[model samples]
Target: MEVLEAIWGLLAVALLAFGLYCCYVKYVHLKYDYIPGAPRASFFFGHLPYFWRKLKNKEVAHDLFIQWAEEHGPILRINYLHKISVVILSPEGVKEYLMLPQYPKDPDIYSMFFNIFGVRFFGNGLISDPNHERWRKQRRIMDPAFSRTYLSGLMGIFNEKAEELMKVLEEKADGETEVDVMSLLRRVTLDIIAKVAFGLELNTLHDYQTPFPRAVDLIAEGMTKIRIPFFQYIPWNRKKVKEIQDSLRLLRRTGEECFERRRKAMLNDEETPLDILTQILKSEAQEGGCDYDSMLDNFVTFFFAGHETTANLLSFTIMELGRQPEIVAKLQAEVDEFVGVRRDINYEDLGSLQYLSQVLKESLRLYPPAPGTVRWTGTENVIEGVKIPANTALNFNTYVMGRMERFFKDPLIFNPDRFGKDQPKPYYCYFPFALGPRSCIGQIFAQMEAKVIMAKLLQRFEFQLVPPQRFKVLESGTLRPFDPVVCRLNLRNPLGF
Candidate 1:
């Protein structure tokens, strides 16, 4: 009887505290009432339900943001519970915020990313770290890995993996069979990152039974659940939660084994292959070393970050090229002229494919793999004459800003010509790899890898988009083609080889 009474008393106190916190949240949120935004459907849930509904229906969240941008002007405030996040969809705002390091990534948003299903995902990794100084330290240590000399050495591996993919497609390029280009691209990119970054032979391209690829896919798919409040407690999500946890365990386990092997090699004074993992280990040793878990954090980071964005870009570019044959012909001509019948693509050949470069830039303008980045405003700020509250979530997206009519003429049209040599460069408006000090360290590396794979594909094949397939975007870790970029391929000018 006494224990029961005590439990009841504690429950009463907890309920009362929760009620007060809710009241405080509501009061604080009202402070941003002046910011222009869509009418709230409910004070408690805000737009989260709407966002979730869109995701549930296999739709992109950025489309809704674009709609609100059109309706409520470029700057809008969206609320979830008591939190108010500001969305900036203008070039001026993007320049003011993204072009400077004054803004750091939103801790609240990044905190959500630090764990998936209670397992640490990108904990303190370069992408999920909110601390500016710490992130800078990591970035400085990892810079040498992405240098031109290091990446140039990776050309052989890039060509080898791409050739494996081409051979796979060659088997299916009989024109009667439909191939899911995006899946094959994902496998090839996954294979490249594994081999180049960690010196692991993932063999995802050739091996259909790899558990790592399926685990990664599950992890990406399961990441969306992070947005739901107290998702783990929900009965329906128990199976999903367990699956995500299992996937995370597999990745972390593999990461630990890889780290141990590298450490053992260094300890034995063995010949360590110069790769990203070696660079990280060298940095760790020189810097008096970080914990093993810290190394694991980066190992997982490099695997996901180094692979998905490049694959998405390549796949999206392929889909667009299929839709526009004339543009494809132009790209093919550039590749043919520069690359000729060479099966081996060198770093020098990457620069001369100017038309292909424009096509890539144009594709990124439309479908930025990561969509956008969010910044946490710790103090009140002003942008474009509008007052912004402190402690607000600020979202700036290339996808939104790149599509605005004010920034790009005929924004809806996919025109690679807009990126012609004579055309003015998009300074602030175009940030596919983001901008400022927090910009992606692997930008050059990703683009170079993309160019190699794309050059080879264009040189070898003529692909037609399979009809009845929706070319929409999937909001996974990166935005991928919703229908997997299904295509029917035929060898183009077989004698050219």
Candidate 2:
């Protein structure tokens, strides 16, 4: 009771003193030198309470970001508990701040990735890691996998998946009923990705009930693990991370098994049938570059990045088409003129459809898969007009950038004419695949996938909105439309196809 009480009293006094000091620093000193951003801290927790990260509505997210931008003058700070990050809003600011050598492209959200995948797999990937030289080398290694002419060679895979999707829709609407276009698009995207990335051709669209498809489904569930943020510090929530890690390991093991089988088949036959994965293997073999682990890393990266964006973009496009009948009708006519009621749309005919391209560009502007991109200052650099010292984290919300009034004439309105031939070039203003030296390599693949799926869907059936047009946001690590987007797909040559 003697020494223990004295120690306890001293500890309490020290804690109280420290807490008071923290309050003074946050509320007083931080206001002057810490850079302006969020409101002054209300003592202990700082400004943590202001972060609306749980927000599911993207419009709300957009509005809040705009508010921050206005107040903080483009670059601003917000505390994620003890970690403080600066958010940059303008595209100009991105070029100025994010592109500078001083600001390294820190995959800041990488901490959120947890154990579902490790830094070795996800972090080492082209999108996540930002070392400019390392990325250049990795991009070169992965280049052949998505060569302009080479990817179009896999058009057959998309055609096959598209036809299968049509067949499933036919069965569901045997006598003309409603079906969820979003779910159907997800399945089709998965199947196409399955064939191109792994060369497995699981046909997840036709049979999602089976084991392989179930595993794929589980992978999607694991992706949703991105939302659980507090799991990092609270050991209790680490179980979710462990569960995701297990799922990732399971999928990776599946990829390895597929890689081995594919290699074996190639060894036995020498010239059976080779696609992107085969090409990647051959490319790696010849150059003696990129070890097994690196290739495997890219295998997972492309496999995941390849499908989800295409699926979500198509889903949103279909939803928008349903809302805008005139646009849908026009798009149908374009599909009809190029493709037909009697045949599938081939690669040769894909380019002739100009309107098809416009619709995709417009939809991408509205709901870009990547909500924001982050970079850290590797050395002292200036951005947009602000002088940023080295090691400062600069995060730009590209999703918000796409909808900025400064960048576009009317930010909220959806118009494909924004991308028409005569329209002024929208260069830095619109970048769904990002921009500059670090722009996405798989953009060509993504565009082709979207076109094929949409062309096929428009040919077979017409989409009509089942919802009352009230928007709901799906915030994956990327953003998507939540709630099974129900649409009426009336089978016809609605595009006169």
Q: Which candidate leads the pack in TM-score?
A: 1
Residue 369, model 1, lDDT: 94
Model 1 over residues 282-373: C-alpha lDDT tens digits?
A: 87777666756656777777787788899899989988787898999898999989998899998899989999899999999998897889
> Any runs in candidate 2 off by more than 4 Å, and if so which?
1-48, 53-62, 97-103, 117-123, 174-176, 216-243, 266-269, 494-497
Model 1's lDDT to the true fold? 0.85
lDDT by residue for model 2 (371-411), tens = 66677765665545665556566777766767777777797
Model 2 steric clash pairs = 102-377, 102-378, 102-379, 103-376, 103-377, 104-376, 341-497, 493-496
Task: Give Cα distance to truth, residue 390, candidate 2, Å.
Answer: 1.7
Instruction: Using lDDT, give the best candidate's number.
Output: 1
Off by over 4 Å in 1: 1-22, 229-231, 234-239
**Lowest lDDT 10-residue stretch of candidate 1:** 287-296
